[model samples]
Target: MRSNCLPFRADSAAATAEFVRPQRYALRASHSIARCSGLIAAVMLAGCMSAPPSIDAPTTRASTAAIDLPLADPSAGVDMSLPAQRPESLPSNSALARDFMELSFSLESGRAIPQFSRFEGPITVSLGAGAPASAPRELARLVSRLRGEAGVPISVGASAQNHIQIDFVPRKQMSREVPNAACFVVPNVSGWDDYRAARRTARGDWTQVKQRVSATVFIPAEATPQEVRDCLHEETSQALGPLNDLYRLPNSVWNDDNFHTVLTRYDMIQLRATYAAELHSGMSAPEVQAKLPAVFARLNPAGGAVRGLRDDPTPRAYVSAVNRAIGPGNTGARRAAAMSAINLAAAQGWNDTRAAFGWFALGRLSVQNDPETALNAFAKAGNIYRATPGAGIQSAHVDMQLAAFALSAGRAQDAIALVNRAMTPALSGENAALMATLYFIRAEAYDTLGNPAQAQQARVDSAQWARYGFGSDAAVRARAAEVAALARAGRG
Candidate 1:
């Protein structure tokens, strides 16, 4: 989920308290909230599950850099041990059993969500086929005792039959146009034969064998897609493995296993800043924003208390200090700040609004001679806005950046599409100015596309918008010159 600002509501001053910064709004690295800087590169969002920024075409490089660093040793492999015990224990009290007894698993078809189950529980007892006759009673009693210790009312439930159902639902960050591949079953993993059969019986047709489920998570503003997936895989597996290690967990619940396995593969992924640090042995300003989505995906931290991991406050403090240092500087401090925000998102629990703010802020740092970074940041912002709800204004701003970024990236078709999306007749004042910029971008995109006729028309449209939008002689004259150039080119 792209975290961006919610509309300021008259009814919820208290609710919006956490986001009350000195500035009414702050642009992080995202287009949804920042001014377009033509030269800055994009960075990833700093949240869990976010995609990395995609880079424009890389500039041609010589065969070797002036100096190269030594390579690190290969990573040691993970211990793929299967646990002997199940994560969820059975309830002990028969009385408590009824409370959780109704628990069952269901899978969504044609979506990444392999399955999810909710049951009433101080403890819920789900018996495997091998469960002994006394399993339910023992489970209920065990749960009641646990609840009593915690000073909570005891409720428990159990099911004796080994029944499992698979369901599929939408994945997060799913494109509105096309549905990504979903897992009804994965390539290898077991025990849900009955579940698959049941579906065929119910639907009266054979379906795909399996679906591999991915955690539909929001990416931070400064990571990449690969990085986001890796981070999510690690956190999810680490969080859930005590009860269900992928190695030993029954095939009935294999979606969760596959999900975790996928994430483990991404644990080493890094954002541009971090990648640069690793590669250069020093921090450097990111050269582009398009590299963020993948990195952010891998390192986004889950907020709240995780069940088993030891807490580390160092990363938390480091990111915070970095943000403070960047609040005013125009140099390395700003770069550090942007990197810190991404790290913070990975350490802290940031919602869409916070993520959007961070991304917008990051974008601002790229405004100078780094328009590539700015364009990338703007694209990231637009993507965030698309994920965030109740952020029309922010989304509109993001569209403006997307248009500009596309132009800068040499993606003329995309630029025109972004311009079209950003233009809304109802917008006024500052928004109108943005719309005019969209026209300028579209004209630029069309020119790049070698569509001289459309480019000329778009230039005329841009000139009209420039007069209305900027109200500056320089703007009019610059656009007029562009229009004249288009005319001359057509004459030739």
Candidate 2:
């Protein structure tokens, strides 16, 4: 996530401290690959059978700114027809059917996910070592919401019998807790479904017999508060069941491209349907189909009129561009794609939020090669972000980005100003790692200005924030120690 060099003392104290850049990884699924068409048919067939069926399975592969410009309406170019009061009311029978099928099947190679099946028993979740301090409370809130809204029997507690393990860890340490494949292998990923192993029954149905369902979710230590929340919601929900991701689903987090970070009402409906008494883990498509009408009637009774809707292609395109830009290898092509997306979004007059994201991606891609261009892009992003409602946290992120760029450009005073502005109190889960980096930059700025005392204090502050934000991982602690030693030498 962070890539830069830091100044350090040449003394023995400094020699003991090692500085490591914070790097982010992507999430990848391990297993066989299956064609999407076959997967869909398999899902349908699975639900159709009344008797227990045996089957062989195949695998398938899968911004900031505050400006005075006219604020583009957040709802503009967006489908706001989905009722806020009742998310369940928005999905038509067709939508529900499609969503249920997708959720019931695992996308990580067409394997059948052994779901909680029934909410009759307790589902305990425990936080692992180095988890964020806020993890327990935030998880509790999510569990409570799910229990109340989806009738899921889940609670937050540790037991040998615990079915879930949630961990908030530094990126470098992710491989130790989750499978290496589950490690953030993709670029621009904040979290991952690190470990999810389940055993199925002899009937090819996922049953309680010899059943073992354990999941581990990895959250990068550098993630901001909002990212933390989204990760908690999405990863935890996926761990429950519905391990597949469908890009076609516009209203569900199940679609990575949709950008619906939090669990939507539609997501809740799907979960409720999965855990519904009549639906079992091993049901074939026809079997599941037989129970669908009743399920929809009970969930949405009066809202069965199907309205075929699709997510806007602009955002999806923009997301693909950003992903390409940050993707591993192929740096030149990635940057070119990012630039092209930014230009396209600008030319097309995409919605403020979407366009702003494109600009932000461009800024990130161009920061090293073209600081001025990066600054301009970030500033435009900030302007658009300020205009969009409910984007205060995002605005903070932009400020941080600007600060990082300024620091790199040797504009110490400007960097300090931006860092100070970005640090204003806001959300609780703001990325501590980013905050620590900001403080580190501020310290460097003070050092450049020959303000030794202030620089030392800023360095101390940076170390403190890094410890709190990144946990006590060996690398993190080493970095903190290096900062302290650097500050001490600067005073000398």
Candidate 3:
């Protein structure tokens, strides 16, 4: 649920000023399935308006008189050659401070936004309908991670007074769950575009007493395992607090650049700082700033500095190219645009990571029509990513794509092999959707090979992995039917 902050297109200061309230904020993150080019257009058009001339402007006679009067230069007291004055020192490292400010405040709406209201006691979280089968385990794992890193009493279990509910639903269900509220002014924040809405119950004078959070996260039924994991890490973390997205943050899931998909050490520090006992639910920026130093000191007594602030060097052209290719509109034109941009990027020698994404996009677009070419493209991407540190996860994603293509080509045995290769323990633990889909595919493969016993077992495994509320039985049956039909047609 990340979005880029595009400039508001207003004809007058008054119009822009009037936009302060009721402004929606979106996270700018990778939307692997949903297309957002039209969202960009909508934001531009919706914010633009014609404005009349100001009533306080001088009349013609007054302007003439003012022109006739002698006036001093506007820059008279300022020395243009001298260096500008440096502002007050930040509370943390320079990059962290800058990113913290951006994440803590809505520059467009002039709001001193705070994190989600905190609980005084242990936090109990529950999973709702549409949650993945692996939700319970993964959420328990995340709860442990948060408890260890932020020293919060957060746990996942069923309770009468659960503080938070996380729902992992399909894209269609998500659209209904996450209404396009007027508060969401920005568009195309994330693919699947999940959202979190929190309510704070407070006593007199805005003193918060209780908090409840309802978060809806979308996992595309067909999304790859890695994409599912990224969505889980980000949407779930954001639900706890730190709702804002800052592109400037180099190594955090809170950044929209999609550079670092998982939560980083820096992110943990921020969470620790936010949930520090000294800070309250409704503290002002200055108050929080006054306390951050002590919080950081206590958390990092060894002076472990915040790291990974270097911005992604991926060119905009490459990003746009990949987006257009994957987007769901104007297929011919968008693919052409993507190819053109990829060519230009290659000519100029772009980063390997960006190139890998570009090739991945091309592979995605080619899978249905040209399986061989798509496999080659995915293999190239996998090879390129394999050389990078902590990028085995990305390479596994490529393998998942390859497996999907293999399944589409009716090569059930090959698809099963690829799926097995991609289903690493880390990935399986993090993504219930991926585990469900893997089992579903395995079921289909077994059915194709006339192994009904194994196929039924696989179906049970799929449902188990998908949990109870995510339409596991129906989705698995539908996918199996589709694959069977494809195999019968011999279209691959």
Candidate with top TM-score is 3
At residue 357, candidate 3 shows an lDDT of 57
Candidates in order: C-alpha RMSD to true structure = 24.1, 17.6, 23.1
Q: Following a full C-alpha superposition, what root-mean-square deviation does model 3 have from the true structure?
A: 23.1
Error of 3 at 321 (Å): 5.0
Q: Which candidate number maximizes lDDT?
A: 2
Give residue 462's lDDT in candidate 2 (0 to 100).
Answer: 51
Kindly report which residue stretches of model 3 are placed more than 4 angstroms away from their true locations once superposed.
2-145, 153-236, 239-270, 273-309, 313-325, 340-355, 370-373, 388-393, 408-413, 425-429, 443-457, 467-472, 486-492
The per-candidate count of clashes, in order, stands at: 116, 29, 12
Better of 1 and 2 by TM-score: 2
> Is 2 or 3 the stronger prediction by TM-score?
3
**Residue 418 displacement (Å), model 2:** 1.9
Residues 437-479, candidate 1, lDDT per residue (tens digit)?
Answer: 5555555566667786776565555433343332344433433
Listed in order, each prediction's TM-score against the native is 0.32, 0.49, 0.50
What 10-residue stretch in candidate 2 is worst by lDDT? 3-12
lDDT of 2: 0.48
lDDT of each: 0.32, 0.48, 0.45
Error of 1 at 468 (Å): 4.4
